[model samples]
Target: MKTQIRLLLLSLTTSVFFITTSCRTELNEEIGAPQEQTLTANSKIADLILKTAMNDGSGDNILDGSSCFDISLPVTVVVNGTELTLNTEDDFEEIEAIFDQSSDDMDTLEFIFPITLIASDFSETIVENQDQLDALIEACEEDQEEDDDDIECIDFQYPLSVSVFNENSEVLETITFTNDEELHDFIKDLDEDDIVNISFPITVILSDNTEITINNLDELEEAIEEAIDDCDENDLGEERFIDVITSELLEVQKYKDNQSNETNNYRDYIFDFSEDGTVLVTLEDNDGDDTNNVTTEGTWSVRTRVDGGLNTTLDFGTEAPLNKLNNSWNVKKIQEKRIMLDEREGEGISKDELFFQQI
Candidate 1:
């Protein structure tokens, strides 16, 4: 009986000790301190996010009632005493993931520190779980779902190659087109005077039920050059485009607000043409009062307006045109003044319209 009692007491004591140790570990593992970047596997850009909140100022405390809608500026952050740098682009995903998994709560305002800190920290995690950290960073750095704006596009205003062939597919003429005075002078000497390809039309189907079209390449080019010159007269050439419709002016709200009532304002857009005859475009501007202060930004599907023969019209995806009547679009490139839209069309349209130069 004595032996059995001693054995029972020993077992109970061991169980109690194990439980105590486990509890102590759980308590120590609590995350109370700021995370260090060197120990992380991802690259994060650090930007300072300021919000108007009602929190006590530790100089690091966020303001009262601030949310993600607040203006956020891109910034770089250094961590581990400036030994590491982080870029928001790289670590945005990973940090977001960590927040999702670890914290049941989130702050309305967040800060992105810097990129330099991330670079330094990445080098520190080179050994041991460096591979793991790298994998984590890559996973976190997974490219965010990009909108149409993230699509690849180009802007070209130059000459291109065009080949003319008879029904027999025999090459008749191969020529290049350019707005350059020298090139135009050369084309003027052509004997046949038959142009297989022409400039891409500048077409705008506006919101107020109006359509503005510019089909003449020479006229369109002249208008753009003239507008640019006019802005240059006031030394605003570097600042303003020849024609600006709905445009966005950052760090300059009052001026932007005056230009258009649309919340997203800014006439400048990106235009890209692929060698395979794909035209891509994206516009950046807010078009309303934006009372909530969330700067509106989005992109538009590139429309294929005109084909090479001047009479052919190609339609891109079906999206109602939101452009205003006064909006101006321009063709930036033409290969022998030819626009390429498909393969069956020989040598594709050479001259590519690069962008909609809003007037």
Candidate 2:
């Protein structure tokens, strides 16, 4: 009986050991295995990723005159007889001001060549002369009749994070991109089975400088599609009007306050905008006479907004009636002898209108 009991105890002990070892092995396998996730081939999110990562050519379109590529900066250019070293994107406005100096004269821009051209894929080509630059522009124009696929009106605010997962849904790595170039290359070289999940709550800036938060892939794709063509991407319209504002001797023809439902025929005030950022304001006597005119000096400037839109700002230093017009006004319409400007009150709910006609 003693031998049988000892044998039974040994058998129980062996069985417990085997059971514990088996359970541990199974648990280890489960913990070590990778999880599975799917990123569909040619998916909408994938396409959006590619588009967002594409090079933005419109930012430097003023320099290259092409929407397909950007001219690398620190280039010298002669703008209407004025030599300017354009080291940054902000210097483009100086060129525009030069072009606006004279509406009647032919605006000229001559680049000091041997400048670098950057393509949509971040490839670089050295353009030695005007001929080479022209060739590139011609090729780009022929290739794309409409605007390029790059969505310039909206930009992804960077330092974006993404996770790469394997077939078993195990995260293999996490990548962070600080710029479009890095993000573009990574997405372009993605493998067929690689699953990339973007860390969400990314911010996108619209052409109006409005920020939108995207929580998932669907929202990002939708935002890009909606804002792709929402802005004046070419800035051609703005360039044409800049000349009109600076050249004409303008008088306030009408003013309307939307909030108070008031209208004023401001035919008494004449404005002359000088290229040197000064304005001569002449206030005519309200009694339908030019005899008792009061002349005053004010400052005027055409400023480029963050979205690339232009705002004409006027400051008269607390002068009555003119002080009321001291806000940054958006150009609404530009005609041969008349320009219309409006000031909006919060998301354009209400507005004050100001019309200027050449005197």
Candidate 3:
């Protein structure tokens, strides 16, 4: 019930492929990346120059002189006194190239006098006739600013805060962001292996003070349903459900297939879940040869829903129970002695189902 980092039905994996294309394409032009960088007026120009070009590179955060890492073709940058049609890394090298270098060494270039940069998508940034590139580099040492702690200080873009909560409806932590630079620091400090999966209703307080709340599991499912309803289902449909649940196996307690004339074949089934994400189903062979009973195995997992509920699933190369438990189910009670899974009105496996009890 409290704020937690839970599922938002956002494509966690597919988003990885298109995140730069989707999010970074329209970064605020007024600010530099890594906003906590200390810079003189000269280095500010350089950083903005590199940041804008790297953005144009589209997914390469740093310039490495490769085509993928190269700033796109036919752009213009007025460095020193020359406006060059900068297409490739070689074109950039015309300004300055080091041959006495280590292969791993990052290639470097300093802006010239009366510097100006023109990106493919952004307007021009100009610094007119200040000093030569070498003179500006010399001034960086003289102009570096210091903090109260005597460390070099980089200007930040202000601060924000986000709240985190847990499954028991308890406050876990409230994270504060001092600035855009601090945001990078916070991400860099996180241990991916140590990240905990909490129940949802996670709230983000942006710098401009707006709120986005993915309240519950049903809401996410509704979002997917609505998204499909708004467009053709053939287009990126699985991307819609990818974040909700990643293929969990549900135990077949009592399956009553309405289309089949089957009744007594559903008893004496037990489920075993292995650490390697394998689900094994052992059931009594009422209809088949008793001495040759087989074990059906697949994959399984339970994830926290947006509403603080849990989804339990089962799959063995089919969609009987997986399709059923894919929807949100409330937790009536859970303890060492017993567990209760409450199913709501939706696409369910059974018709006369009351509740699930495991003791």
What are the TM-scores, per candidate, against the unseen true structure?
0.15, 0.56, 0.23
Q: Write the per-residue lDDT of candidate 1 for residues 230-324, one digit (tens) a residue.
A: 21011111001211212422111111112334423424333333333233445534564335332222332121111201111222344423232
Candidate 1, residue 283: lDDT? 51
lDDT of 2 by residue, 8-60 (tens): 99999999999989975664444333322223447766667777778866576
Candidate 1 Cα outliers beyond 4 Å, as residue runs? 1-196, 204-212, 230-359
Query: 99 in model 1: Cα distance from truth in Å?
Result: 20
Question: Model 1: how far is 31 from its true place, Å?
Answer: 74
Superposed model 3: Cα runs more than 4 Å off:
1-265, 286-290, 319-332, 335-338, 346-359
Candidates ranked by lDDT: 2, 3, 1
At residue 110, candidate 2 shows an lDDT of 87
Error of 2 at 121 (Å): 2.3
Q: After superposition, how far is residue 220 of candidate 3 from its true place, in Å?
A: 38
Worst 10 residues of 3 by lDDT: 145-154
The Cα RMSD of model 2 versus the native structure comes to: 11.2
Model 3 misses residue 34 by how many Å?
68
List CA RMSD, all candidates. 32.6, 11.2, 27.9
